[model samples]
Target: MSQVLSVNVGAGADKPYAKVRLTGIDKRPADGPVAVRAPGPKRGVSGVAGDFIGDERHHGGDRQAVYAFQREDLDRWQGELGRDLPNGCFGENLTTVGIDLEQVLVGERWTVGDPADGEALELEVTDPRIPCRTFSGFLAERGWVKRFTADARPGTYLSVVRPGQVRAGDEVRRTFVPDHDVTIGLLFRATTTQRELLPRLLVARDYLDAETRSLVERRETFTLDDA
Candidate 1:
């Protein structure tokens, strides 16, 4: 059975772009259950109510509202780095156990608890998170972003279906699985260094986030123009 191991959130603060100083990336697990609601277009359309997103242009939105990572993956990284990897270390709101997020298809839906409340707290898997300079700086490791990307374990992003409270140890179940080949890892590779797979993203056109859809369309057009 899959469940949330941690529920984490953070507040916004000033940070020197060149130096790390309390950025939201260092999220700590919530002391208890935390309220999570979609901040709709009127309210930044990205993070939940209590969370802070440092970059407006790249972070947060309907498609990237919540970030989730596999706790088991973190454990492995901890061993590799000889460090303590706490929940939300990578800024994920929910750290899950027994969930294989890598192969999750775009548009797959998950309910964290009571189908009723979870109906609102429902989360639809969207895209793979692309780590940024902020992440690299936060970890204080050289080529952190490159290393993470190369590992191809970038966690998945999710869109809120129903807004409600989420806490650690909530039951997690896959409510729906879309019929598509755009798994989180596949999509991540397609968008990043794998140019060969860009054209394949069109298979899940309607379900893909706008940015990715646009990328596929543009890539297709470019391919045709050259042919």
Candidate 2:
């Protein structure tokens, strides 16, 4: 069954490896339910209660409110890196198992936990996370950014649709899938390695996060101006 292995949250702290000196990437598993909601118009606010985002200009907001990574992917990285990576090691708010996050379509909706209890969190897949210097530094891996981008399983960012609380062991049910072929993996490729694929993202334009939408719009404008 698809379930949350852990619900993680970070308190802002000093990080020598982080370019910004302070970071919230070292998330730890929460002991109990954590509130989830739409992080208003703020740039760096996190949707998960008590969660912190380090970079205001590049991270968080409504679209990238919550980040999730698959346990299978973490295991794969652990194997490759020859180290033990616990849940939330990648700075994910939710460490999930049994879901193929790479194939989850952009705009796919997931209901987490039981709604009858009135605290099920609803999240929509928004975009694939782009690896940054902080991520690279966190791992202390050589050429980490390039390696992660090349691997193309950058995990998925989610936007909170229905405010509620989530806890570890909660079941995750796919409630909706957009009628577009823009999977997280595909979108990641389009944004990073394959510029030619940018045009293909138009089909899921409405589902894209703000940053990705802007990028697609710029690409469209460039194409038109060039023509």
Candidate 3:
């Protein structure tokens, strides 16, 4: 029962780095062709390249930019950035439309692309991206960090299954499936406030990042051997 909300493309669509923005309901029970290729393992790829199951971005400290925006903040997101930066700040390639992106938990699956392909590809939610100072500073917003983490609206990270041109207005159909049946809120709480509830957060380990894992590991170690 997914629906298309709004379709927004860049004003400079013909430009070399035109941004594509889509805002609307992600179609349900939709599938499109996905052509995934290995971007590389953390850093750079030297050998064979083809569709890959997973790819890491920071492993080799290689920075690959993409679109990013929380679901609820879309109303004035563009304006906000424009006002803040005056010359455009955030580099989010696409701005989601109708979906309350914050609600999408980790491990959720999405099928993106034209319907003619018949469920052509799948993308999985892997981790939460904690924005760094550069991003925050770019917007010149002081409380942006607190607001982002507090909202826990960590936009979903995609494990691209099919690669193709994703333009504005393209429907993004989402399927909720938690590997450990836990929510992102629970994990965020377990790590920050409810340290005692760390075990519960383990349910969604597959969605955790290295920093989160390390925190959990440290907590576990402390619990196992108290000196």
Candidate 2 CA-lDDT value: 0.91
Instruction: Write the residue-wise lDDT of candidate 2 on 1-227 in tens digits.
Output: 99999999998999878867679999999998999999986878999999988799888988889999999999999999999999999999999999999999999999999957565789999888999999988889999999999999988999998999899999999999889898999999998999878888999999876667899989998988999
Backbone atom clashes (below 3 Å) for every candidate: 5, 0, 15
Query: How well is each residue in 148-181 modelled by candidate 1, as lDDT tens digits?
Result: 9998989998888877767888988898987777
Tell me which of candidates 1 and 2 scores higher on lDDT.
Answer: 2
Best by lDDT: 2
Q: Which of candidates 2 and 3 reaches a greater lDDT?
A: 2
Question: How do the predictions measure up, each by TM-score?
Answer: 0.91, 0.94, 0.60
Stronger candidate by TM-score (1 vs 3): 1
The models' CA-based lDDT, in order, is 0.81, 0.91, 0.45
User: Taking the tens digit of each residue's C-alpha lDDT, what string does model 3 give over 103-122?
Assistant: 66656766655667764444
| Candidate 2 backbone collisions, by pair | none
How far is 150's C-alpha from truth in model 2 (Å)?
A: 0.3
